[model samples]
Target: MYGWADSTAIEVLCHTEQCVVCGDLADGFHYGVRSCRGCNAFFRRAVTFGMQFSCRRGGRCPVDKNARCACRACRLAKCFAVGMDKKAVQPKREGTNGNGIQSQDNSFDQNDSELENRRTSPYFDSVQLTSPESTYSINHSIYAQLTDYTPLRSPSPPPECPFLLRLCYEFSEVKRRRKCMLCKSLEEILTEDCSIRDPATAEDFTVVFQTQMILMFEWVEKLPEFKMIHDPLDKTKLLRAFALRYMLLDNVYHTYELGYNDRLVFVNNNYIIPGQPSSNFNSCEVVNEMEICALMFGAPMQTLVSELVSIIHGRNITIGEIMTVRRLMLWNPGSIGLSSNAQAIASQASNNAMKELQQYLEQEGIEQSEQRLEFLLLYIPALTKHTKTMYEIVRLIPSFGKMSEWNSFMDDVLRGV
Candidate 1:
């Protein structure tokens, strides 16, 4: 009897395949399962709309061609049982027929002559918006494609002496002017009388920077490469290098988010306007010190801030791009004192993050992705330049160094010891 049943199954397989759910003659495979056109369309619609169905009787209704329409809930359950894969379903293509009704093409054509052409075309891939999982799969595929491009290597060491000095000097001058402008704008804030003698207190700047550092630390913890670094010391070192730039970048983002006009940056509800006298010191002493600091280091910091804010606002940088840039900054392979092995790991991680970012940009349908990538690369140098300037300023200011000692993380960042 088993042999007879096997023979009957073979015979049935030899004939035109029937829909596993509806028992109607199958029209090839739809979403990885053989089903008739009607069933295929119904399944597509159900999945697309996230349609739920109720079976009148415990969902045991027999689903066949004639009775399939009687209980959609049972039919859908049977579709899944028969190995219908919703992930395999291609996104619906919209087109208009002569009648002007919007028609959806749900077919997944594996053997189309245009497949290779489409794959090679420089166009963004269409993603399924109906499901998060499907969107992720599509994004993963896009990232895989981006990974096919050359991997990024560690950047070359900085040029020695005069060249580096010249670059830093030019950058410094630009930064100085921008900082002066920022400070002058905030001078008005100081002119207004508050209860406190210091309009822009050191306590306020410290509070803001420290609070931002906490947020930055949390952000760094989320990156894959940072998490992979098992050594606490290494993590601390990386975080130390990352924190300042992260704070500056985040400030740029915040400045833009608050509207371009609202340039006053408040940290922990404390505003740190350049040139504002601190309540902790005599008015003359605070003014002279702030002026000296602003004249020396303010421009470079302000220049970096202005450039970053302008770029982000002008280009409408997405959160995804910002996240990717953060990863790049955090995993900086060129950071001084990293071992060869650490550099190698960082290079690979940075490349992977870049590829992911490329996919994100493509999905956003942003034009000139290649150009955008190059622009992002430029930010690395800007970050390095600004960081060097910040280091110099911190070294010069004994009080800032003392304040940094209050927070262990900030202390580690300041001393680098």
Candidate 2:
């Protein structure tokens, strides 16, 4: 009887120590509340940014770890009601630009020196491509030049077959030349001084994911094919669907590079091992919101990525391979509400690219070249599965969902779903 009573007391003590906001194990007192880092960060950002939120459910929404993300308004309200001090939040430090004046803008600028450094770096020029067949060389060059050619502002009619092929080629080149971070080898990434560790808090994840999404939008805008989609609605829908799949593919590629056979991969090459506390929680016995989210979503995703890695294991995926797959993904024919003409154009482009890719692989003497071609085709379904999971997770987060209202690109993507 005494043993039972002691156990009950311990259980209550543990429960009391849990974060009041998300019910995750608390990481000690933060901003005057016993909360996990995710909640603590969330509250801090809400206060610091003067972020406004509206509840989809009229403010009565449950604010547990599982449902806390459902309503930002309620979540923030609960934070205040639970004694999280708004005044405890500190101002973000201002960063200086090249001239050393404090810059007010916190948003990442493409023209920043960091990006310029990468563009001029000798490492980017080190990748040596063997001279392709004359046909491939001519097509590749044409596509590469398309980055400099601006699309017509007026909505033009669908391009001709030859033009479609050129557009596909151009897309492949643009993606290749952009030096996608995902395309970098694990060794290269690890050696680079800019590698950011995995985000520990919900706010950090939100910022990193949102930044990646923005970069993806910029990448899409550079595609001649995307600009050809005249209808604003169609463009939005296509971009949204494409963005989701793009993010998934990027993550899968990164996971492959890292050789994370069974671990969960996040943006910026950070990963989480299964059944273990993530790097952020090493100091406390607490389980963070991200760790919980990963556990719930990571297993199936890891399995899917592992299967993909196994298929292409030991072989270095070439620039042509990556380009062809990217081109095929961009022109998704099955996206909801895609027009027949667009579908036809996309299908033709993908088929043409596939033929070109097959020829290149065969010329390179890859064993089972035909099988390797088919493997690229297999990425579509796997990417779709991962994208759907991500979309569901994003929808649950009110802040991300709210993005649709403020960000046109995000709106198009979310609304297209």
Candidate 3:
């Protein structure tokens, strides 16, 4: 007998703590209850199904000491009165680590300790956003912002920062000016210089920063062994979008080195088209292996990718159109220019999408539209990566130049990789 009266029915006897909702002596049954059966039942219902009821009159509802259970709303308040810990409610599972795994102690505190280590980690410390504002407490904001994805957060930082940082930010205006430029070209730069300090309202800029964090957590969630393995080399690369940030800026710097002395390439002024130049196929686009390595260091693996897909499909996307609009405007500067290459790609994508939609025009084929959109989105990037135009345009940019002096530079980045 753990101090309960109705032995067969299991009614816990009340000590000094009475049910806050009902004056009846409470038993320790429902959610650390000290209330009556009605209140206990209410709490159990609230916890089990997540009912959100509001008092029509106001917030304060009465609770009687004897014949209690006045208002449904009052019962919930009583729950808080007795101290049901909200923090104790575990966060829902988001995704797995890079290795597709999880552990028993999935507490926020434990995750914070891990992030703190990566922050202080020598290789990553420089880029770890130590600006006190970036340091967060264990709360809803942190979880809402970062930890849900673990894989990308697991790796050490790239070693080529301070210099790389200086190089990328030098031509921030180009991103603003190059509205009609080839999208693949612009996207390449975005990916190359993804690690540059986030720009004000820049689409790719925000995506790079956000992706870095999301991928980091996703990386951890995917790989269970990442917790046990201290070796930094085992991590997958960051998303190409993020890696391109540094790579793109590096290419711009190389452009100056290559004597492509057109200031229009890097400045805020637009380059006028003389005529549609014939696409060249044989050019070698500079890769900036160092930045790519850094990008690789921060990439999310399979688990995170799956989670992101789930997040997008889980909600009614139509309601979030406004958010999508903002993201597109930020990332695809070409959205403002009808003639921009991004718009062209978008148009091409739309056409393909229309073909996918045609399948559902006659019947209950709506499900195929979702699948079609998904496959197209994934496939588009892969297809775009292989274009001759992309290769030519990327080569014209400077960062693609051969890094004769990369041995030392690479050594630095590899120290953390």
Query: Which numbered prediction scores highest in lDDT against the true structure?
Result: 2
What are the runs in model 3 whose C-alpha is more than 4 Å off? Answer: 1-17, 65-68, 86-417
Between candidates 1 and 3, name the one with more favorable lDDT. Answer: 1
Q: Lowest summed lDDT over 10 consecutive residues: which window, candidate 1?
A: 180-189
Q: State the lDDT of candidate 2 residue by residue for 1-417, as single tens digits.
A: 121222322232233345656566565667755676667766755565556554443334566665555555555555654446666876665788999988865433223324323423232112223322212111122212222231212133355534333444554333232222222221221233434355333333343454455446545655565666565545545655677677666655655555555654665555545444455444533334454456433575456546554455556766567656666777773746767666666667677777877777676677788777777788677767666666655554444322322233343345555
Q: Write the per-residue lDDT of candidate 3 for residues 376-409, one digit (tens) a residue.
A: 3453343223222223333222343332122221
Alpha-carbon RMSD, each predicted model: 24.3, 21.6, 25.7
Q: What lDDT is reached at residue 126 by model 1?
A: 24
Ordered by TM-score, highest first, the candidates read: 2, 1, 3
> lDDT of model 3 at residue 25?
48
Residue 346 lDDT in candidate 2: 63
- Structure candidate 2, residue pairs in collision: 240-413
The number of clashing residue pairs in model 3 is 56
Candidate number with greatest TM-score = 2
> What would the per-residue lDDT of candidate 1 be over residues 116-169, giving only the tens digit for each residue?
223222122222334423332222222232223211122233565222222223
lDDT of each: 0.51, 0.51, 0.31
